[model samples]
Target: MAEPAPRGITSADLEAVPAPLVAEILDGVLETHPRPRHAMAAGELAGELIPPFAPPFARGRGGPGGWVFMIEPELHFGPQVVVPDLAGWRRGRLPAEPATPFVETPPDWACAILSPSKARLDRGPKRRIYAEAGVAHLWLLDPADGELEAFALTEGRWLLVGTVRRGEMVALAPYDAVPFPLDALFPLDAPAAPTET
Candidate 1:
């Protein structure tokens, strides 16, 4: 007799699936769905992905810069599909090109931009997922507040390195030379009005 399909693996079954299977479904949905608002912020940050300038760095063959990717992975945290605004993987670890929307690999760094619809996810469970996945760095950009919070994983704990507000220039880890002004991440073009003018 033929061997039975692995426990809960099935074309129609949506419940109690394996990790890889869930990853595949998540990738498919993100690819077909319309891009979210956070995509713009992610795109802007992509311009900053460059060579690492710090010592003791693990460089990839593609050069000093790693591969930055935007992924929507189906994390088995709860009931929802938490798609991060942006994610990056070391160049050597990146999946082959044309591998559909969601790559089954955890990114080296993950970024989540807070929008009206996604504030809770970005700040809560999604943050936990990145940490659990052992993401080396994470950036949480709040466009509305015009702030960017950078975190690094040290000894498996997320440590807040910097909280950048308007006019503050923050340096990111793993790529020390790529300095970014906090104001650039915000969408506002004009400064807040002066008090008591």
Candidate 2:
């Protein structure tokens, strides 16, 4: 007789995992990655955008203030759960903060900072999940090589919006209102540009 099929992972399995190891349910499988001690300029990117795009500041700081930003938010999309480095939702769409442990509503925009161990998941399964969830924008940033790629969901697929390299000023959507130097988000010794990895 043939062997029985394996059971799928569930939320309980994800929640039972120990701390310091970040976990997510990707395509029905429980996935975990080390929580880095440092965010490597990811925080800088948020610092630059939050003051202008998210509230308590925004319009007061001469920016289009209608966004709510989250860092490493556990987002649930049906049976799939994945966390992005940074995620944003338009204030109108998420007028009030969610009262639950995880956010079920998809973000308007999501960004991932490529990590050697997690790149495959970020570029593949996560991308498909985001597209399937109707996320409007996606950004992939490689700080080691200094590159940022912007993508927009179109016709149920992702369309390459643009790629801003180190030393270049970026005005990419959906927060294009404030143009900032891509170099500011990388260290002084970062490589020139980058190629898809």
Candidate 3:
């Protein structure tokens, strides 16, 4: 006989896991999704890149200024809960400080820095979830490739707005107040010099 599928997991099940562990819900099942080294580095790089242009609005790190720009914030949408690499909410949408641990208001913008382990899931289930939750803008950053893809929600579906390859400069929406360079998100270490044979 074939092995049985695992029981459907819920938000409560995820809550039972240790705080250090990261969990995401998909199709009513809970899954462990940890950030790899590059993924974490990419998120930090993004955290640095987004704040300067978003001044006057509170994004986390320096201070809770105006907007709620958070890294790996837990988002609850109906029965599904997700933690994107980064998420932000405009001050107008959330006037006061968020009183709850999990934000249900849905983010105005969300970024997912993809690693090999998560590229498929992020591009598929997570993308669909964000669209269903009505997230306005989505950014997919591939740290290894130094590529960025921006998407905007239109008519209840996600449409590719633009893409920035390595070493190129492009302004992404929801934060296009200034043009941002793609290479900033992924800094390359100096290549070792060739040995004299």
- lDDT, each prediction: 0.57, 0.85, 0.73
What total of clashing residue pairs does each candidate reach?
Answer: 0, 0, 4
lDDT of 1 by residue, 1-197 (tens): 11223443433343444433222123122211224465555665654553342112326323354454545543332222445666677667764543543355666777877776656556765676677777789888887787788899888788999787766666777555567565555444554333341
> How well does candidate 2 score on lDDT at residue 79?
80
CA displacement after TM-score superposition, residue 117 of candidate 3 (Å):
1.9
Q: Relative to the unseen true structure, what is the C-alpha lDDT of residue 13 in candidate 1, on a scale of 0 to 100?
A: 40
Candidate 3 TM-score to native: 0.80
The TM-scores, one per candidate, come to: 0.64, 0.89, 0.80
lDDT digits (tens) for residues 1-197 of candidate 3: 11222466555676886675677776666667555466555565556545653456324434334455777888989877788888878778866656878888899999888887678778998999999999999999887766789999999999999987765775777776556566656555433333343
Estimate, for each residue in 1-197, the C-alpha lDDT of model 2 and write its tens digit: 11222266566777887787778777656777787533967798898899999988886778988899999999999888888999999999899889987899999999999978788889999999999999999999987667899999999999999998876877999989999888778654654553354
